[model samples]
Target: MRKFRKDNLVVEIYENRIEMGNSAAEDIADKIKELLAQKDEVRMIFAAAPSQDDMTSNLVKISGIDWNRVIAFHMDEYIGLPRDAEQRFGNYLKKRIFELLPFKEIHYIDNGESDPERICTDYLKKLNEASIDIICMGIGENGHIAFNDPPVADFNDSKLVKIVKLDDVCRQQQVNDGCFKSIEEVPKEAITLTIPVFKRAHNLFCVVPGITKAKAVKRTLEGKISTECPATIIREHHSAKLFLDQDSASLLK
Candidate 1:
């Protein structure tokens, strides 16, 4: 593994899946334990995607982490999807993590059956009131972070959450991940946590795997800091780390 710092952010790149997942999960559990040692309650943000499967699974199995004292928040949700919908990101988290563990509170972006702007406003208000201790995320094959795809990504964006149209690359990635049967089946719009909100977390753990992510991973790590490759802006944060399996880090120098 290779470790470095860009500003205040700490980035770590690992060689393969087993090591990457194990180390990332331990690091996350350790951070959570540290926060609980300091206070009664801790807040966190989670990303829902296949890239996070190993880390999330390992995280729930770690003992003495006080799952009940954590308040969980999610990163994004597809607009207009029902809570019960198979494609719902909220439902994904509920099944994969939240339902298995107890949390003091779990706040999800309710993009179903509400005016998009109003939902964003309400979610933003909730975020502003809570100070997030840790955030777990993944880098997209398109170099997108959260739902912040290229054309729409805004580094200086001030909104906490907003509706965004899915770009072609982002849509195809969903198809590739088996989240949808095809690009046509994927939702066109989503409500996403803005870059500013992601940057606010005290610690960020970015887990990226698969050979398909190799090119984007290389760009995010080696390219100029810009909205084009949204995840590249991690360089701007002080406490972010990137965990990559060999497949994803293959293209890196």
Candidate 2:
């Protein structure tokens, strides 16, 4: 692994996605162990995506995490997918990791709620109820963190959770990632945890892989800190670390 710092962001580049995932899982496992030693429970937010496959799989296989004492929350969910829809971020994580573990509790955004306002209010309450310790995330091909795409991202958003319209680039990414068969199949709206909500977490880990992300990764490191490229904010975060594979880091200077 090649490790370096860009401002306050820690960057670790690996030979392949597998290696990057393994290293990220190891760092997260070690951090969880350390946090568990000091507290009775640890609250963590997880990002659901093909990008996180290697990391979450490796994390679940690590033996010492004591999943029984950990609380899991996902960062965002599509606005209208059915409760059990495979594309729903919550259900996506459920099939891949949550069901495999014994978490203290898992909180999911009720995007199925008829009144979107109520869902956002309830989720915000739960989030503000405690301090979030760890966040495992990914940068979208469009440089979005979670679903905070450029058009809707706000660094000082007052509401922790809110609904936002998905941008064309963001919608196309779902198809590119194979989450949807085409852009039309993708939801045009989503209920996302605003950028401010993500900032509440104490430690953040962004794992990005593949050449598709090479441009976004490069912009994150070199662009101005603006919502034009929301991922750029990661560079200003004191406890944020970005893990990248050679392909994803190919465009980085």
Candidate 1 structure quality by residue, lDDT tens digits, 1-253: 8887655557677777878888999999999999999999898999999999889988888999998899999999887566688778889998899899999899988845468888888888888886889999999988998999999999889677899998999999999999988888888999999898777778989999899999998898889889889999887787888888889988988
Residues 66-155, candidate 2, lDDT per residue (tens digit)?
Answer: 888899888888877778779999989999899999999999887456888889888888888889999999999889999999999999
| TM per prediction | 0.95, 0.98
Residue-level lDDT for 216 in candidate 2: 95
Runs in model 2 deviating more than 4 A are none
Provide the RMSD of all predictions against the true structure, rounded to 1 decimal.
1.5, 1.0
Which one is best on TM-score? 2
